[model samples]
Target: MRNKNSRNNREVMKRILGCIRPYWFLVLLSLLLAVITVVLTLYIPILTGQAVDLIVGKGDVNFTGLLAVIRNIAVAIAGTAVAQWFMNHINNKITYHIVQDLRTRTFHHLQVLPLSYIDAHPAGDLISRVITDIEQFSDGLLMGFTQLFTGVITIVGTILFMLSINLWITLVVVCLSPLSFFIAGFISKKTFTMFKKQSETRGELTGLTDEMLGNLKVVQAFGHQEKAQEEFEEINSRLAEYSLKATFFSSITNPATRFMYAAIYAGVTIAGCFTVIGGGLTIGQLTSFLSYTNQYTKPFNEITGVITELQNSLASAARVFQLLDEPALLKDVPGAPALENVQGKVSLNQVYFSYLPEVRLIEDFNLDVCPGQRIAIVGPTGCGKTTVINLLMRFYDVTGGSISVDGCDIREVTRESLRTNYGMVLQETWLKSGTIRENIAYGSPDASEEEIIQAAREAHAHSFIMRMPDGYDTVIGEDGGSLSQGQKQLLCIARVMLNLPPMLILDEATSSIDTMTEIRIQKAFAKMMKGRTSFIVAHRLSTIRESDVILVMKDGHIIEQGTHESLLEKGGFYAELYNSQFAPAG
Candidate 1:
């Protein structure tokens, strides 16, 4: 298990590096600046030691030489600071660009993913992965690059200078260095376990919050606020617990490592004093040696601090990779033909399907519709009505058998081409954040103003749209939230009208509207359905009385099929359902 985790960490690191590959030049430039900055900064210690030696050897302060040395050292420090600032600026640029690439790739993948994948994952969790996780990854990379580059250079340069001054003290420093690393490693190992758990809990909290808040209307309608709060508190408590543990461990790492380094420094000073007293080491050399010891150990401390942050970053990266590595979504077959000049004849032959393998939702489903026929499918809530539409639209692929349009298998045609041949309006209306005119002309981007007005008129939505603040140009809020439910549905109908495809699907399309408005919309739909193949899924028997044929579905099977009058006379399941809707009260 340990080996597997190590391998996974390496894989995640590799993918993250790939994101930086495009910005390699910027990264290299930052490193170049880092080297220059560290080299110039190192000169300060050497210059100070030389000044000490000059003043002490003459037993008198050389104010002229001392002033000159101080001036040069001050200039070098200022230059080093400027170079450090430029390196930081470039590092930030690289970090943001890499984050942008990650966000773009994740969003594009979401677009191409099959609807099944979207339905299976929570919207909030996916949002966390795309936004929150990527930001965390960016922060870690920023710190890792900023400190790691200069820290490495400082360690190497300090050691080489120390070797030139005194080898014995340098060896003593080297032996004690591993103690800090071991202490850091011990703390990091324990903290990583806690941090990983904390991250997962945080994602779950985000998902729950999104789910509850996204459906706040339902929660309030059912008086579930207390229950919701309780659930939130429970999860919040768990998150606090894990976060406390992770933070506590990381917090102690620094002081614990620092204590060890202080002891090493004390030992080095004592040993250097003996050498100085024995006339083997000069006072200037001792001064420089002490400076080098501090410089050499500083990187380990910075690295230890960064390692704690990296644990959180790696946890977030694993989650992002998990989302990205989901099974590739359904795609158009290679060299698939484009659907064109559709005649609207559709068939589902021996189709079988299930949301889960152990629980079948559809089996042996067979249906055939001739060109320009009006078919109404009536079924209870879970009888696969929406599933049928999902399969027809290729939003999901069938597990068995095939769906075809004009004898061409849907899987063999490009999804974009196949979907373009049909217009659909669902019970759940969806409108983007746009003007009324833009919503109506969504699919038909090139539609003229006159054509858009005509489509709105056909869907019985023109009057309300004209009443808005900007008339037809009125901007709608997201999902048409500013408009009433009926108004949103009407706009969706207008969108479909503008498309005017050869095939049409109306899934409880007018369920939210009043009787009078529904009557007008139905009249308009009747005219629209005149020469188009149409599928209507409605629970109201009154709406389908004029359908050429009605299918009654139950338990994923078509239990009955006939006209309204024929099914009523037969007195079967469809007859029972139709009568129940209109049954007189006791």
Candidate 2:
């Protein structure tokens, strides 16, 4: 498993670096600046030694030579600072743009992804991956490259400078430096799993918080506050534990590397003293060599720190790549023809489907509806009513057999064109944060205000909407938080009415509205259904009494189908369901 994870991590790294391909010029510019900055910075220690050498003795200083060296050092320092600034600026620009592209790509992928994928995953988990995880990955890359390139170059440059002075001393420093590397490698190996686990737990925690906050009303309705809080605390505690463990291991690497460097420093200082006494190295060279030794070792510490951060970043990148790598809705069937002028004649011919391979949700389901017919589907909860809608909408493809519209197999048409012809109003109303008019006109963005108001009036939402201070222009809160449930449902209905698609699906759409309002909306729907094919999935039998054909489903099978009066007289499943709703209480 560890080997597999390492391979996967390497693959993710390749893809992550590929994000920078478009901005390679900027990256190269930033790197050039970084190298120049480090070169000038290393020049400072050499200048320090030169200034020391220019001062002959305690009070017999070569003032002229000292001033020249000082001036040169000052200029070098200023130039280095400027180069460093530009390097950081360009690096930041590259990092943010890469992440922005990634975020946009992820969102676009979501738009085209299969609905089944969305339904199977937690919304909060996906949100964390897109937002928090991607941000973390970006930060890591920024810091990683900044530390990595500068540290490596600094180490190599310092070693080369030392070699120009004393070969033995340079060799000693080189031999001891790997001690830090060895220790860091050992500690980092242990910390990798911890950091990866901690990242996973953090994502889970974000998911938990989102799920709870999103449904606070439901939690309160059943008085589930205590249970919810307990669950949160449990996950939070686990996250804290993993975080502490990962942090503890990573924190030790810096000091451990520093400790090894201290030992190397002490050895270098002692060796420099002996070399100075032997007349092989001068006091000035010895001083400069010590400074270079410190410079050389410091990069080891910084590189270890970068490694620690990169481990965590890699964990996050893994999650983001996993999402990106998901199959994209089967790709609209390679050059599929576009659906045009759909007449809404839909047929399900021996259709079969399953959410899971072992358990079928729909099988051998058959239905035929002529153009302009209103078909009602009534069934017990979880008896495949919604599954029928899912299949027709191509949210999930049929595993066996096929479904067609106007005799054209849906699979042969581009999803964009096929889905455009149907308007849906679901029980769970969805409204974006926008003005009332915008939400109603969501399906038809260019809809005129007059057309918008007409659709709202048809759905019986215009009066309530106009009561608000801004009327149709009033901005609704996220998901219509400020509005009542029925009002949100009304807005959804108005959205579909404005689109006026050739086919419509109402999945218990009026359940939230009051009886009188539902009656009004039903009348509006009847009027709207004059030339369009309609499918109604309703638990309330009264709403579908006038449907041309009523389908009774049980355990993925269409047990019966007929007109309301015919089903009632037949006294089967449909009649029993209709009678039970209006039946007198015991």
Q: What TM-score do all the candidates reach, one by one?
A: 0.96, 0.98
lDDT of 1 by residue, 1-586 (tens): 5677668778988998898899999989998999899888888888878778768866688889899989989998999999999999998898888888888988888888778889988888888889888888888888888888888889888888888888888888988888888889888888877877887888888999999987899999999999999999998999999999999999998999889888988998999999999997888778878888888878878988889888778888888888888876767888999999999999999999888899989899999999899999998889998888888888888999999999999999999998898889999988999899988999999999999999999999999988888998888788896799999999999999887889989999889899999999999899989889999999887999999889999988889998999999999999889879999998
For TM-score, the strongest prediction is: 2
Local distance difference test, candidate 1? 0.88
Per-residue lDDT of candidate 2, residues 58-153 (tens digit): 888998999999999999999999998898888889889999999999999988888988998888889988998898899888987678878888
* Model 1, TM vs. native: 0.96
Maximum-lDDT candidate:
2
Position 292, candidate 2: lDDT? 93
